[model samples]
Target: MSADLLLSKLEGVRRTGPGRWVARCSAHPDKNPSLNVREVEDGRVLVKCFAECDVESILSAVGLGWDAIMPPRAIDHHVKRERRPFNAHDVLVALETELTIASLAMLDIGKGKMPSDAERERLLLASRRIRSAIELAVDND
Candidate 1:
């Protein structure tokens, strides 16, 4: 299917840059153009709704099925699929929890109270997790 068909169904559609567009998502009551649409060289179209509406719902709202966006074709076995196992948001959330544990343990020590064996182990775990997160960020950066 043509991307023009999808854009025709969208309200407030406008070009952003080459092969990119912004439009109002019909799946939700969008006050602005919260939907992003991009056409790649492979003729595959990508659609994203910033309002967190699932792609399926957005497509359905426009009376388009998956075939409109993703035309079925032969799969390329040689292409490598990218995987981001740890996103920044999840990594930061984990780091925050670990830091909170260490902070509370430090406060206990400041009050002249010794942390138990479990607390010490948890502190060690926090340090390890922090180190791991740093490595992940650095390598990706």
Candidate 2:
């Protein structure tokens, strides 16, 4: 059921690199490994047969269905949708914290003091957080 176990069932499977593998295609007679298998970061398996074998045929040869490589659906379409209330309390709190840091940095600048490396890093982070908050607010609208 797992990607590793499914790949092990194939012939001539070799590790090409991290999360990458070369294997012989079972759909047709082959001497060299022409199938490329990769496990993506999001836990989805990708299979490609350089010999031009179709996905359905390749999967059938190895006793697997399309579901083996497809990501599971988060929500069933058959279920009715529920309306959830929008909550911005956490976003507001984060914005407040970032603003406080930025204001402090501005005060230091007004006093003719250069920020230390750590303070500069904090200021950069606060700037990014403020931008993200603005984007989130726009998206909600």
Candidate 3:
């Protein structure tokens, strides 16, 4: 879950400035916002509970552990699909060609020199099939 969403769920929590906020520690007996919670832009939290509450205990009180609270990593998915790899150039070629052909057909329709009804239908169907194939390919491994 996003940090902002998690922070919003904490009762009596309010941002006072950039990366600086005040909140009531769920593990402590502070009546006011005695916990100073500072979140960096990268989502690393620096919390100090003035009521002598441990940071780890406080995080657990807020329904988050160390691993659970860590920011998302950009590592690629390890679960491989039972299909072929995706090639950027191949995808670009397919998309660009599909769009170009579609645009040409649209221009022809505008000029009143469109293809035969059957031929136009065939082209439209082909475009759809190609698009679906491309999407499937991209979604695969």
Candidate 4:
């Protein structure tokens, strides 16, 4: 699989600040963030579960099969490996990421404004910009 494709799929799950990701573990009842998926060397994915889950199990949880993503020689090795399918839940995650970024931008705009009507108008405009970015992503999909 292309790294770009995988990166796109991981858009929302990738956190922006200190922690690099926010993923729900498929191996456990993850009501909150329990997994961190990161891009390592040679486009390999590095995953760690906060709940003390194993790597293979975490791979299986994301709905990804090794054959399609791993090298041919490694296919048999990862035959039993699996990941959660990219579904509505994944989409929601991406959308949430986009929204979070947008929200930050909105906050920045708000902070920049003084005690004036123009500041409010600029904040609204900045928020619209964020909304537009999200709409574009959905439309393209």
Candidate 1 ranges with C-alpha deviation above 4 Å: 74-141
Cα RMSD, each candidate: 16.0, 10.5, 8.9, 21.0
Q: Give the per-residue lDDT of model 1 (tens digit) for 1-141.
A: 447888989999999999899999989999899999999877778899998999999989989987887656514323434445668788889989999999999999999999999999999999998998888767655
Which residue window of length 10 is worst by lDDT in model 2? 74-83
Name the top lDDT candidate.
1
**Candidate 4's residue-wise lDDT over 53-134, tens digit each?**
9866655556555532455545454554444343666657756765675576667768984434665665566567657756
Residue 119 error, candidate 4, Å: 84
List the candidate numbers ranked by TM-score, top first.
Answer: 2, 1, 3, 4
TM-score, cand. 1 vs. native: 0.51
Pairs of colliding residues, candidate 3 = none
Candidate closer to the true structure by TM-score (higher is better), 1 or 4: 1
TM per candidate comes to: 0.51, 0.51, 0.44, 0.37
Supply candidate 1's per-residue lDDT for 39: 90
Candidate lDDT (C-alpha), each: 0.86, 0.81, 0.71, 0.58
Error of 1 at 137 (Å): 42
> How would you encode candidate 3's per-residue C-alpha lDDT over 62-83 as one tens digit per residue?
7777644455441222334335
If the candidates were sorted by their lDDT against the true structure, best first, what order would they fall in?
A: 1, 2, 3, 4
Query: Which stretch of 10 consecutive residues in model 4 shows the poorest summed lDDT?
Result: 2-11
RMSD of 2: 10.5
